[model samples]
Target chain A: MMTSPDSTGTVPVTALTGLSAFPLTPLKDGQLDQTAFIGLVQRLVAAGVDSITVLGSTGSYMYLDRAERERVIRLAVQHAAGIPVLAGVGAMRTEHVLAHIDDARAAGAAGVLLAPVGYQRLDDDEVFELFRAATGRSELPVVVYDNPSTTHFTFSNQLYGRIAQLPGIISIKIPGVPADPEKARAHVAAIRAVLPEHVGIGVSGDAFGAAGLIAGCDTWFTAVGGTIPVPMLGITRAVQAGEPAKAQALSEDLQPLWELIGQCGSLRVSAAIAERQGLAAPDCLPLPVQGLKPDQRAQLALMLDRLGLASL
Target chain B: MMTSPDSTGTVPVTALTGLSAFPLTPLKDGQLDQTAFIGLVQRLVAAGVDSITVLGSTGSYMYLDRAERERVIRLAVQHAAGIPVLAGVGAMRTEHVLAHIDDARAAGAAGVLLAPVGYQRLDDDEVFELFRAATGRSELPVVVYDNPSTTHFTFSNQLYGRIAQLPGIISIKIPGVPADPEKARAHVAAIRAVLPEHVGIGVSGDAFGAAGLIAGCDTWFTAVGGTIPVPMLGITRAVQAGEPAKAQALSEDLQPLWELIGQCGSLRVSAAIAERQGLAAPDCLPLPVQGLKPDQRAQLALMLDRLGLASL
Candidate 1:
C-alpha cells in the first residue's frame, strides 16, 4: 500500500522484484580492486538484477577508509548505469554520516540506506533523532535499514510508524526475523499497514520468505540477487504479477542455496558465496569471523548445484 | 606472576594502578582541533594521570578518516612526552589492523590497545590468526582489549592464555565483569596464573572497581579517569603504595562522582563529565547518543562539587 512520493498517485512500486545483490567490494594486495568491482557489478547487471546496494555489511563498509568508500561508491554508481544504486550510509557518528552522504551525492547515488547510529542500546526517541538528523543532512531520498542481528537494536512498530511519516524516507529494508516466520510476517504486515502508501517496505532475507514479503510488502531485498540475478528476477517478477505457484516453485529451487548459507556464519557465508561466484577473491573476513569449513563449503556447493547456480 | 619476555623480572607487576584517562580528540567544525586536543592532554598530564590512552572508543577512532587518525595519533604521541600512550588500533580486517599499526608506529605510540575485529563471531583459530598477524605487524608492546559489550564476543580465558603467549602482547583490558573486590581478586589471580609473567592484566568498569583492580590486576582502565584525574590517580598511587587508609579517603571523595555516572548512562554520563571537566566539548557525542539531561548535568555538578573536583 505504500505510495510514491512523486506527483503520480500510483505507487511506482518498482517490483522490489528481481535480484538485489550486495556485491562484495574486492580488495587485492591490500587495496580496493576497482577493476574487479566494476566487473562484478557489470555481471550482476547483465544477469538482470533490478537494483544493487553498495557498501553494505557484506561489502565490508566498516573497514573501508573514507577515500576508499568514496571511490567504491563512485564506481558502483557509474557501473549501476541507471539501475538505482542504494548507497549504505551507516557510521558510528553523525559527522561521518554526513561525510558519507556527501560522497554518495557526489557519486550520484539514487538513494541512501541509513543504519542506526551507535551499536549501543537506544530508546525510540534516540532512534527518531538519528533518522531525523540523517534526513536533515541528506538531500537524496533515504531508505531506513533495520538489521537488528548486526546492529543489536531493532525498530519497534511504533518507531517504524513514526519514521514512515518523515519527509525524506522513501522506503525501509526490514530483515526477516530468522527464528520465527510468523512474527516476521506480522512485522512486515504491521509496517506495511502503518507506512504511508507511497513508502515502500522491502524485506531482506532471500527467497525463504520472498513470497510472503512480496505478498505483504512492496519489494524484496535479496542476498542472492548479487550473483544469481536471472532466476531471482524471474521469481520476483512472478510473485509481483500474482503468479504464486511459479514464485513458490522458483523459491524451492533457490531454497537450497539459502539453506546452505544459513548453516554457516552470516557475512562469512555471503562473502564465500561472492568469492565462489567470481565476484570477489578469496573470502577475507576480518578477525572474529572465519571462512567456512571444507565440509560446509562442499555442502554449499552441492546446494548451489541443486539451485542451478553451480557456476557460483 | 606474568613475567616479562625481557629480563625485566615478573613484568614489574606495576599494579596497573591509577586513573588512566583517554582524552577526547577535539574537533573544530569538522577537522581535528589540534590545539584543543593538545591543551586537553596537557591538562590531563598536569592533573597527574597515571597514563593516557589516545584514539580510544571515547576518542572516536573509527569515525576518523585515515589522515585524521594519523594526525590524532601523531599529536597524542608528541604531547604524551614521557607518559605511556596506548593507541587504539581496532579495525574490521587484518589489513586495516596493519594500517593502524603502521600509523601507530609512525606516531611513536608506546603501545597499541586492540579491540577484536568486531561485528562477527570467529572461532579460536581465527582469533589466534588475528593476534598472530597483529603481533607480526607491530614491534611495540600491545594491550589486548576484551570489551565483549562492544565486540559482541567475549575472549575466552583459554584464548587470553593463548594470546598471552604471543610476542608483543604485554597487557589486556577486560571489562563488563562484576566489579566486586573479591571477584576482582579472583579474576586477577586466575588470569595472572595462566598468562606469561610478562603480561599485564587490567580492569575496566565503574570507578568503584579501581581499588579492586589495584588489588587484583596490574592496571586499571577507567572511563572516569578521563574526567577526574587527580583523585583517581591519588587513589591508585595510595593503593599501590600499601596506604589503604589514604586510598579509602580518596575513594570516598571520588565515589559520589562515580555513582552519579552510574545513575546516568555510562557513555553519555562519562562524556558529559569529561565536557564539564573541560576535557571535551559539550554535546559532542556522535549520532544516536544524546548529551545528558539537565537533571543529570546538575547531579554531575553536585558530585564534582562534593569531590572538590569542579574547579580542577
Candidate 2:
C-alpha cells in the first residue's frame, strides 16, 4: 500500500496506471504561452488522465530556461489541481538536478522524473551519486528515468536493482523496447522481477504496447494521452481490470494516432500531436526541431477523425 | 577594414580576429569562482590575447543555468577591460539565442559567437533561420560558429555562402582537422575561398595547427591559449609576423602539452589544463562532465615540465 509523505509520512507509491499524459509546453513570441498551456492542461484533466508529466523531452524541457521551467511547473501544478504532476528534472550535473528538484517541490510537483546525464555516458558510481544527491535534495518521491535510446546510456538491470532500493524512489519510467513488443514484454518482466512490488514500474512507449506494459507493469505513459486522454485512460483501466478484448479494441482505435506520432521523432511527434488536438501551437519546438510534414499532419487528422476525437 | 556597427549610421561588421580563447568559467561549492576566473582572464590579457571568447562549448555553456551564464559573462566583461570579450550565445531556440545576445551586449561583450543548435540535426533552412534570427536580434557583430563536429551539423559551402551575406556576421570558427594537417590545410583553403576576404576565419586545433591555420587563414583560436596564454600569444605573433621558423619552434615546444590536453575530451581537457596551470580548480565543470584520467594528468604534467610551464 502506498502512503502519503504528508499524511502517513510514507506516501503510498500510487500505481501510475492509465494514460499519463505529458503535454507539450506551448511557446508564443519566444516565451511560454501560459494561457494556451493551462487550457491544454484543463482539457487533458477533463478528459480524465491519470497523471500529468511536465518538462519531459516531449515538453521541450531541455530548451526551457530555468525560470521558465519553474513557471511552467507552477502553472502545471495550479491547473492540474488534484491530478499528480511529475516534473522532468534530469540534467548532466547533480547540482543542476538538485536545483530543479527544489524547484519542483516548491512548485508542488507530485514527483520528479529524472533523465540521467544526456550528453555523455556516466559510470555507475556517478549515476548512483546523482540519484543519491537528488533524493537527498528533495523530499518528494523521484522516478528514475532510463531512456537509453535518447540519453545514450541505459541503466543496466543491476543498476536499476540498486536504484530500486534507494529511499524516496517510488518508481522507474522505462521506455519499452525501442520498437519491438516482444522485447518490451521481456524487458518489463526482467525489470518487474527485480523491483519491489510496492515500487511502481511505468512504461513510456504509450500506444505501442500500452496493454502489454499495463499487463506487465503498473502504468503506461503516453504522449498521445496528452491529446486524447479519455480513450487511452479507458484502454489502460480496461486492461488492468482483465478486459483484454475491450483494451485491445480501444488500443486499435488509438494505434493509428500513435504510429503517426511515432513517425515525427519523439519530441516533434509529441508536439505535433498536441497541436493537432488544439493542445499546443504547431511551431512549439526549440531549435534543431522543425514542424511536422503536411502529410504527417493529415495522417494525424485522419486518425483523430477515425477515433471520433477530431473535435476535442 | 572592419568597421564598427555605429559607423556610417549602419551597424559596422567587425571581423573577430586572432586566437579567441574561451576560458573556463570556474565555480567553487556551486557558486561562481570569480577570483579564479578573473585571474585566468588577467593572464590571458597580460599574455596579449587578441580577444577573449567566454562560454563556448569548450567552456561548458550548456551545463550552466541562465543566471550562471549571465553572471559569468558579466564578470568576464568587467575583468577583460580593453580586450574585446566575445560571449558565446547559442541555444536550441531563437529566443534563447536572442536573450543571450541581449545579455552579452548588456555585459559589454565585443561580439557574440553563435553556436548552432547542438542536439538535433537541422536542415539548411532551419540553420539559416537560426543565424538570421540571432543576427537580426544582436546590435553587436555575430560570428557564425561552424564547429559541426560538436554541433553535429556541418555548414555546407552553399549554406555558409547564404548566411555569409547577413548584416552582423563577420567570422567563422572552424575546428582544425583532428590529427590531420593536410585536412586542416584543405579546410582552411576551402572555407576561405567561399568566405569573403573581409570576413575573418579562425581555426581551433590548439598547438598542432595554430601556426598552420594562422599561416593559412587570418587567425587561430586555442583552448590552450586560455591557460598558457603567453606561449600561444608568442606563437600567434610569430605567425602574424611571417616568422615561420620562430612560429614552428614555438609550436614544436608546445606540441606535447597541446597533444596531452587534447587527449582528454575538450571540456574536461581544457578544465584540467586550466587547473594544472593554476588558472581554475579541477572540479569546476558546470555539471555532467567527468574529470581527466590518471594517465592523462601525468602526461599533461610531463608536457608542462618539458615546455618550461611547470610553474603553471
Task: Tell me, by lDDT, which candidate is best.
Answer: 2
Give me the displacement of residue B50 in model 1, in angstroms. 2.7
Global lDDT of each candidate: 0.70, 0.72
For A1-312, candidate 1 gives per-residue lDDT tens digits of 223332311122233434467777767656787887898789777876677888877666776767888888778877765667777888876777878988877777767788774544566787888788777875577888887766777787778889978877878888764435466667677777788877788777774546555456666676656655667677777877888678778877766666765666446666666667666676544444567878887777777776667664
Best by DockQ: 1
Across B72-116, the per-residue lDDT of candidate 2 in tens digits comes to: 787777777567788788776677788888877776777888877
Per-prediction DockQ comes to: 0.51, 0.37
Local lDDT at B59 for model 1: 73
Alpha-carbon RMSD, candidate 2: 4.0
Model 1 chain A weakest 10-residue run by lDDT: A6-15
Per-model B-chain TM-score: 0.87, 0.90
TM-score of each: 0.88, 0.86
